[model samples]
Target chain A: MEALIEEPGTADTTWESRLEAKALIPGTSTGVAFKLWVGGLLLVLLVGIVAYVNQYNNGLYVTGMRDRISWGIYIAAFVFFAGISMAGTLMSAILRITRATWRTPITRVAEAITVMGLITAGVFVIVDMGQPLRLYQMYLNGNWQSPLMWDMMAITVYLTSSVVYLLVPMIPDLAFFRDRLPGRVPHVQSWMYGTLSFGWIENPPQRRALAKAVAILTVLIIPVAVSVHTVLSFVFSTTVRVSWNSTSFGFFFVAGAIFSGVAVLIIVFAIVRRRYHLEEYITERQFTYLGYLLAAMSMIMIYTNATEFITKGFKASDDDLFAFRELFATKFAPLFWFYFFGGLVLPVLIVAFKRTRTITGLVVASSFAVVAMFIERYFIVVAGMSVPLMPYEPSSYMPTATEWAIVAGGFALFMLFLTLFTRLFPIVAIWEMKEEHETRVEVAP
Target chain B: MIVDLRHCDGCQSQGTAPQCTLATIEGHLLPEPMEWIEVYESPLEGGGTQFVPTPCQQCQNPPCVNVCPVAATFSAPEGVVLIDQDRCIGCRMCMAACPYDRRFFNWGSPPVPPEALLADYSMEHQVQAKVGTVTKCDFCVDMVRAGSLPHCVAGCPQGAIYYGDLEEDLATNGKTLVSFKDFTTNNNAYRLKEELGTHPRVWYIPGHGEAVGRDPHTTGRMPTKWPWIERAKGAVTWKR
Candidate 1:
């Protein structure tokens, strides 16, 4: 086993080659820790399935949702997951478009997060439905005019493009795995690598073709990602609810999605960097740059929130007053305040200060941002529904045990996808990193 | 339909629960917490409470119909918004879009009497309500077609609810027939949330139960009941 491990920097005599063997180590080996982690995820998934079965049998009444506050944690989780997906695709696309050399190490991780996040997001919509079996009707009897229909179309297009975006750039890496580790890996793993590589030889023509594909996708995915979040916000904005009836919701939701997405990316970078022993590859520079992005988004979110509230409050109608009271002073106040201060403001403070600008600090700030964004989505769905439509007293909603279990399941599924993908494929784009290192070495002399 | 608020004492003078709501529930075999024609006791501007019996407005430009993803809910040719439960995916976008809070969902197998299952299902009547679909006051289009008054109009002891045809220019409150245009114009009738552009067909004549010989200060009305749920087998009920 020790003899099978290649020496650092042997192949290319560069720092990029030093991490190449280390990057493939996770894909080649299965430790007890990895198995235990997967076991835990499967257990949570089982529990979620049980809860969903109960909900399926007994109807949506198994959850705390009712006629008045019809939506709950499921819709919120859908929004949160969907929001987090944006950062991965958007970051990869933008960084690639700008020719950012530092992006090479983390682009693969970002794309994986986008795919898994979107799959989980789509699942939550099904879990939230009262009639899951009727989902096919969305395709068969779809109303093109509805915002939800538009969201369905947008998500499908985005998911397809995202998968292509993630896969197309990794063909050379797959060919590397096929050539280097044939006898060491299992038959199915070897087969997957060979079949997916599409006979890549990394010649100039193949490289040019890959570059053009990546270039087109990088440009195309931005508008698709932007449209996805905007259409999602339209699901709320097009409604007649006082809090949801805003023209600026399209821009607000896009900003919020990117904010949460960047935070998630930072957190994932820290975990993958530490756990996979790739510190030399994924350095503090990535965290610092991503932290700046998180802070910038936090500030934009603050501006959007202030603009939405001030403009709505300036001409407070009777319904708008009730909505304001519910969000600011009444039932939803605690979550709203926590999301504002703990989630948005604290992250900015952490990133802004020189003392707390370390990797660990960025991770903590990102964790806060992630949790805060989820709370924001929750209150947006619940509190928006809480405002009384008529003169009657406001309605209330508290997610049931089943709801919590299902949500936990969604997170577990996302982790499982990342975990399994890391085992099967290289997490880093090795060829891109090597290319970047070669260019840097030529410039140095 | 026209609801004369001046005559609506919320069935208080009759010493019972709001008869309009009760009759609709019985007539439709609706589940608990689904008052199709609910009587809301709203606080007056000066200092009093008034009962406003609200049914579905049957809007000509309904937000609910516009936002249904599967086109399961649609506006009828007669301007009534109806939901086809068989086609509904139960996404509840319609419920979110309705400003009147009039729509109801069958969260569980709704506790309807067994006899309701025997009746043929129709979009107009919504009999044998299915689980996980939306339902609301469909304006009793079937009864109106049959040359009979809606259950709410007939059940109102004060004759406050008038079922009408704007195309025909006529309306009746089970006691007297009148020109729909003349009655609305003369009584200063108004629709709810006119600025929302829903163009609601239901109209209201504002007052505080004065025509029914009741003081505006009377606040509470009897809570609605699902009297048939006691005999409903294999069905469940949930709170709103």
Candidate 2:
């Protein structure tokens, strides 16, 4: 039994110590680069806040959204962020369940993104509404049959579980920060660590309890995550619009979630790796592995796009033809082609080629995927609405300056969350990586 | 439910729309600015033209009601769909879901006329005069409850629009009352986009721009005037 344990203690312990010594060290201060990045985001966010205030005061009239195009960039951004958030559960829980060894160092980055993404996604939905306070009215006078109600319920469930999923793994790490960082940072932050750590002493019983909780939560969150993505797509599919009323939408959206989720995961991974200089933890192998995932996702996305087009193109309802023409031939052609070529095609080519499978290539590819997926969401919503359900002339939806400012604010807020998260806590899951090493080492209890 | 296209030539002769839209806005003082009925001039395939006057289909399975998160829009017991502007959170999901494009939103202050001030608000006779909410053709629910034809049915100058009690099998175009089943069957009336299973109660009796002396090549449409612009000098009103 002892011999069956695969711990070569010397090699394993040295690696474990290295991870502990370097990876756990917080960036010394808000460095000039960090300050500049945050300051820029803050400026954008402030501008956006002003725009949002103006929208509230002046009514939705400040935006270009007419009755014809009721939804605009805010709803689009909601879908984009909601889909991107799946990276957390996808990277952490699903990969953990599958027992992927290489996912350990990068899971925290994914989970942090999930938290930030889900929150910002919800924020955009509020922004889209004529009255943000009506969100509560929806809950109070809830309609069981409304897809919007279902969407709200699904988001609440998913968000709760995601927060738990994010926090559970961070407990021991929080305790670590609590014990290690108080002397180094300000008193208020130190107090925060102490309060959140929940006295995690890491005794065998406590450790077992947390492990059990994490395991249960991991199993619990997958369906919830799937539901969040599906329900959002349902908001469109359930509508009577010919282009959106397809049965294939749920599966298509889930695929899109994974595609964008993995793309964002790679981009975040690259930034963390570069900024923290944790080359050893986030390896070239990680890039290669993610490249394979990205390629598969690109293929799936392209296939879904093609299927959506072919199925609609074959019958060619007048509405379908009009939308298809707009999507493929005219107004939206530039955006459609850019996403097809730059987001889908370029990503596939980059990931498939060994030379371009480097971290830089992966980052570039993921950037295209992220931006294009955002546009895809925008296209799906605006294009769907752009076609007047009646024979009335088709009206165009262009985002107003206010809308653009709010969108920029949303992006800045998301980055601000990640930035603040990294400043206070280790961006990598410290305890989990150590645990993995310990199990491999088979050290004495 | 049947529009007899053979007898109807959209408003080519009348010089105005099925005027129920004017009646609705003036009657309800609604802020949603909904035209209870709308007229469309669609080009026909054989180099002719057609007239499509859309009313609230009052679908058996309403997409608007189901998508409204707050139950702001709902179907009444008699099958006419309605919106409660008071309860509406202004999410506009109802607007998005209505395939007929019958729904309208109050983006800002609804322009109200002096006459509409002090109008009692009800779900059926809405002054949705609220700043942010959805409103649509309610099938003149208030008027029907008062034992009257829908405003549109009464207002159409050419007597083209019809109102009916489907359950009772009676209908009227203001001038003549007839059997709902007989009139539809005789006219070969069909619901718009019946393939979608919306089961819209409003039926088209078919027209090739011929009724009211329509000219297919003319491409003329009824001009929609908001009606209040002709107010007698200094009519007192409420704004907000």
Candidate 3:
């Protein structure tokens, strides 16, 4: 609702001048709004920690999960955050690889998002464990056959690669900040920037090496990101539970990750742009392009859902039918409907229709997509686990207040990381801003 | 083990009273929903019914062992699937992978007697259950290694549940010792959910629970109890 204030979309100022001035200048914007946002996040974080501590004392007995339904909201949140993390890196990689010149404004923002997304997502995996301290055993006695190991490997690879990918593009910017921000920034920060700058002399060979490293990294990240989500999907699909066992799972998960990833990136984009007043650089065209991508992903999700239902339903496996019935018509029908309509149908309409492709409309649609995708994951985990394998009584999981508190903590941490990320470094891609600045000076005298 | 449901009843023997569930509870002091061995009502094609004395199938390709992330559950040389409680992180992925749903997690500190806690913990025997780790029927492997019949097999009054050595081609049901190969082949015994390709260790000759005195019209699933844990006193868990 705060974003309802209209943007000066076609602001008369050109991007080059604005980019040179504001791009390298670090934001120190703190007001009632920023204070309130951080306060709310900290309060939620505190509450979440207290709730988690209580759960640690009582065991998972305090949660809604039981023997019948083992996994719950924590695992689902892990998947959601993993999917969102997959978005920024892949899209940025795809854009870079495909030579999309207009990606200059938000590439750095996307990479930062990927970093936070993976960190938060990885934390959820540990939180889900009943014996988190025994996590090191996974290193010493890891089973190669288990899908969980594949996920661990994929995430480890992806997180490291993402950090590198994020760092690669920032070198030139680090040098820019090192040179430009000495008077503007605190002495320690200036020193830190100089240390991170890596002694880039801007010679042709050095620039060429940086570009080559970036090009290689951009190409390398997509597959790792894709594999991370695909491997995560295997954790569910590898099980003999017919509801979870499906051939289409890999494709479905990868596609869903990208779809949800785009939605999250859009949300992040809106927040960063509006908060920092980057209207001159971010522009309406960038939103429309992302909107189009979102529209396409929405269609793919609908298709994936259809394919899953058709193949799984037609098999006539009792477990599958029971699970499908549980999701489509029984206790989980409302969530299923919301995922189908609110997630897929509404997003498609919002993005496809030309007049509604405005920033506000896209933001609204993106919010719906994010929430609905989360619900979709919740349904897959909870509803799939609800049906009994041996035809005993069907069991249900209703997350306790403790689970809700932990979930709230996860979200608050996500927002907190994102809020702090913008402050720690230049949110704008400084190297690109410098490029534009030099080019403008060359053209206009 | 092969359970011949045709001859077995769900309850303890009338005179001796040593059914598997009771013996297991007495030995391990397992909490609620942790009956290592249980009886389920397996309905028949006809109007009649029978009780299946269900225990861990101990599959050669055990899904529980294969899916455990930390390798907590490992296959014993004697073909028993044993869980290493010391290494178990209690992720519960194995529980989901199990088609038979035989695995159980210790929700909290399990109720055990002071005498029970004094015994040394053994991965081979699962003597000391942990709060968050998973446990299940280990086929009484230690007892088997000690050259004795499992508590359930020796206790069934009808001599229905048979313990066998497949490599040795011998099986016994307390009163009767028969050829392991011939007993299954002759009786048309089959493994449960044969389509799953688990290559299970246990086989069954299916029937209604009638052999154990179940009335087809009235009886359904055989009742299971967790004597150690009290029923929910307040907020009830909705178990189907």
Best model per lDDT: 1
lDDT of 3: 0.80
Task: Put down candidate 1 lDDT per residue, A1-445, tens digits, no spaces.
Answer: 3346675447554565566677778777877888999999999999999999999998888999998999999999999999999977867898888887787899898999899999999999999887889999999999998999999999999999999988999899999889888888889889999999999998999999998998899999999999999999999999999889999999999999999999999988888887788898889888888899999999999999999999989999988898889888988888999999999999999999989999999999999999999999999898889888887877789999999999999999999998888778889999888888888889999
Looking at model 2, residue B41 earns an lDDT score of 65
Q: Which candidate has the top score in TM-score? A: 1
Cα-based lDDT at residue A338, candidate 2: 94
Rank order (by DockQ, best first): 1, 3, 2
True contacts kept of each: 0.78, 0.65, 0.65
Task: Provide the TM-score of chain A alone for each candidate, in the order shown.
Answer: 0.97, 0.95, 0.93
> Compared with the true structure, what per-residue lDDT tens digits does model 3 show for residues A1-445?
2222112552444554456456553343356888899999999999999998887766677788888898999999999998888777766798877867577788888888788888888888887787888999999999998889899999999999998988878887777667766765679887977888789768999889998998888888888988898999999998888778888888888888888888988888898888887887788988888888888999999998898899878887878888888888999999999888998899889988888989999999999999999999998898888888774678778988999999999999998998877865777886765675677689996
Off by over 4 Å in 3: A1-17, A24-26, A433-445, B12-18, B209-215, B228-240
Evaluate candidate 2 and give its CAPRI docking class based on DockQ: acceptable
Per-prediction TM-score of chain B?
0.98, 0.88, 0.87
**Candidate 2 per-residue lDDT over residues B68-160, each given as its tens digit:** 898888889989898887788888888778888887777766667666666788888776366667777888777877888776666667777
Using DockQ, give the best candidate's number. 1
DockQ head-to-head 1 vs 2, winner: 1
For model 2, how does the per-residue alpha-carbon lDDT over A1-445 read when each residue is reduced to its tens digit? 1122223443454776566555555533557898899899999999999999998877787787878788888889999999999899988888889999899999988898999999999999888887677677786889999888999899888888888888878888888778766566789888887888888999999989998999999898999999889988999999988778788888888888889999998988888787777898899988888888888989999999898888889998888999989999999999989989999999999988888988999999999999999989999999998886777778888898999999999999999999888777777788888777778878656
How does residue A58 of candidate 2 score in lDDT? 71
Residue A10 of model 3, lDDT score: 28
Query: How high a TM-score does candidate 1 get?
Result: 0.98
